[model samples]
Structures are given as structure tokens and as C-alpha cells.
Target: MDLCFIVILLTFDVKSAPNPVNIAYTSVALSLHTDLVYMESPPGLQLLHCLRFDDCVEGGESTYLDLFHVVEEFRKSHPRYFQILSTIPATFHKCHYDRENPYHLVYQKPHIILNHRKQVVGLNWAPPFEGPLLVEEDDVLMYYEAYEELAKAIKNSDKILTYGMKVGDLMIFNNHRVLHGRNEFKLNDGIRHLQGCYIGIDDFKCKVQVLSNQVGDGQPPKHVGNQSWL
Candidate 1:
């Protein structure tokens, strides 16, 4: 019908393949990570609508965590590691041909992003999608150490949330601020299906600002993953 943006909807279905490439389509657990870090600006907001999740499914609970909250604590404890990750650039790539169409995307960015005042504002920390590390000789060792420490901190953080999705469940979250993943599940003769979409940070925040002025909703600006340190 030509009604909406192309590639606007991404479907997640648990099915078997001769050699499954995409983990989202396989019945396996996924580590926590952000989506499409290969893009210059990864999606800001993510929406998922669960169309079917049978009651008999063994274990397919979705999980999420606020990276900002974790980063705040990491900065307090490992300030130097945080700074290293923020300054050193890491490469993220998406070169796959498993689907009907091929994808060859690449982007380079620091795992952490900071503003002039050195406050952590944004991040591009997706391990599964990470490409080769191409940096200066000195930064090679330093980046790995810092990256390892940050990963350990993320694993030790206790702020992660878990939820089991049911039919008709619609979930929306700030993709930049939250890391998302799913646990491996056994179908047990049942099926699970989920559809997802993304809203650009620029567009989403523009609407919020315009509406705030139009309706006189004087609430302060909320940091909804637009790289604002506040």
C-alpha cells in the first residue's frame, strides 16, 4: 500500500534454519545490547508488539537495563576507564547476506559519548555487532582493558529488569538508554511472534518540544536518549 517507511517493521519469530544466522529468528538466548549501532545514529525509541506468545513457552522472558544508570555508577568508580571508553573509537559493522536482501553497514564510534563538561550523554556499546578494533598501537591495549572493565561493571549491575511477553503486549523504551535482550526459550509445541519498529531521536524529540509549547505543558525537558547528560 506504500503506507509507511520502508524497513519500518522488523519481525522476530522463533524458527529453525539449516544454518540460522540472525539470533532473533532463532530460539536462543541473546546477550544484552543496543540495536543498529552500525548506523551513525542508532534508533532512539524502540517499540515491540507481541502478536503471539503461547502460555506453554518454557523460557522467553525479555530483559532490559538503563545504561545511563550503569554508566553513572561506573563513572564514579572507574573514572579513567570511563574516559578511555568515551574517547577511544570502536568500529561496528553489519555485513550479512543471510536474508533475501544483503546488508553491508559500518560505523565507528566510542563505546561511550560525553559532552563538553565530560558527562556521559550517549553510547554505542553492542558487542555482537562489533567489528574489528582499528585504533592506534597505544590505544589497542588501553581500549581492551577499559572495555573489559566496563563490560564487567555492566554484568555486575543489579538494575536490570525482566518481563515475560504475552499476546497483545506492546513495549516501548528509549533504545539509547536501555539495553535489551531475550532469554532462550523452548516452544513446547507453541509459537512466539513479535514485531518491532523504531522512531528517530530527532523526530521524536521535535514532536515533544512542539507539543509542550503548544499545550503549555511546562514540565522540564526529560532526557529521553537525545545525548543530553542531564
Candidate 2:
């Protein structure tokens, strides 16, 4: 209902080695906006920094300074403000399916334990959808480092409300547009994972238009090595 900006930060260090997450995110943000804040570290840590501060091995200081970089890819893509946010540690568990694979619940079954007591809710799925994949909330994990950036973006975006997100999956969206989220998840056995990125809607529209033109010309979209057109 109102314009907003979100910035999610992982307390972990990101300036030690090459940060694949920041490097990859820098590339994406540059596509959408040009006025980005580049990390101040040397080029060696371009894509090898740690994302989840709570999830990496310690004693890797000089090799793991928390370096944050912003790029033009984020600004030119959209004409709005971006915000950031953060999430505490959480765990996800595997899904338990029925004989017919009819899911007992979708989304995530987030749980928490205190004093050795565990709490939970009945099975619940999300988005009112069905697919061949039997994705369980437990399958989620806080795996990727780039996700903390993405989450921060979502938190500080204009007119975007992320319902919360599952860890581990790659969820892509427009940087300056669109909304995203994940159902709440549980914490048992200590596993959390989430991964994602942002793309400009203009770029996506261009790709779709190109694909449509190709199809109209009686040619399938170009393919390489069994992969769809990039």
C-alpha cells in the first residue's frame, strides 16, 4: 500500500575470497541500475565471500571480511527505492507424502523447539498449485549467500511485500518491480537454505518477444547443449 525499501544483511564476512554471490549479484544489479555501491575489497574477493555469517567456518578473517557491493545493474532497471531486511536462523525439514503423493501440506511447515519440546502445525501447501515435484518445507535450507542480498532488496523495495521465503531454492524476480515471499518454516536438525536473484522486467519482456517472434517464424527458440535459449 505504500512505497518501501528493504536491505537484508548477513552478519557473516564477505570480503575474504572471491564472492560468487556478490559477484553474481553485482552482475544482476548492474543490469537494472547503474549507480551501485561496489565493494571496497581487492578484486580477488570478487565472488568468494561468505553470505550467512552464522554458517561459515571461523578464523578466516582477512579471507572473510564482510564486503558489501552495489552496482548500476540495480538502479537503471527500476525507478523506485529498494529496502533491506534480515532474518534469524531457522531450519527446514523433509516433506512426508501420502501413498498417492497427494501432499499433506505445501509451502513450509516451520517449527521451533524450546526446552526439548517441539511444536508444529497440520500439513499446509501454498499458492493453490500442483506440480510433479514433491517439494517439502524440510527440503529448504539457508544455502546461498546471495539470498541475504535478495532478501534485503525485497524488504526495502517500493510496493513489494515478501511473504517470507524458503531457503535453498532459486527465486528470480524483477529488481525494481514485483513482490515475493515464502511461507514460514521450522527448525529441526539444523538445516536452512535459500537462493535467489533479480532481473529487469524489460529484459524479460525482450526475451519473451524474441521467443514469440521466433515461434511465429516457425522456428523453436534457440537451444544449446539441451538448455533453453539464454
Query: For this target, which candidate reaches the highest lDDT against the unseen true structure?
Result: 1
Candidate 2 RMSD computed on C-alpha atoms after optimal superposition onto the true structure: 22.6
Give candidate 2 regions above 4 Å deviation: 1-178, 217-230
lDDT of 1 by residue, 26-60 (tens): 78888889988898778888898888888888898
Superposed Cα RMSD, model 1: 3.4
Question: C-alpha displacement of 45 in model 2, angstroms?
Answer: 26
Worst 10 residues of 2 by lDDT: 36-45
Highest TM-score: which candidate? 1
- What would the TM-score be for candidate 2 when compared with the true structure? 0.22
Instruction: Give per-residue lDDT, candidate 2, residue 63.
Output: 10
Measured with C-alpha atoms, the lDDT of residue 11 in candidate 1 is 49
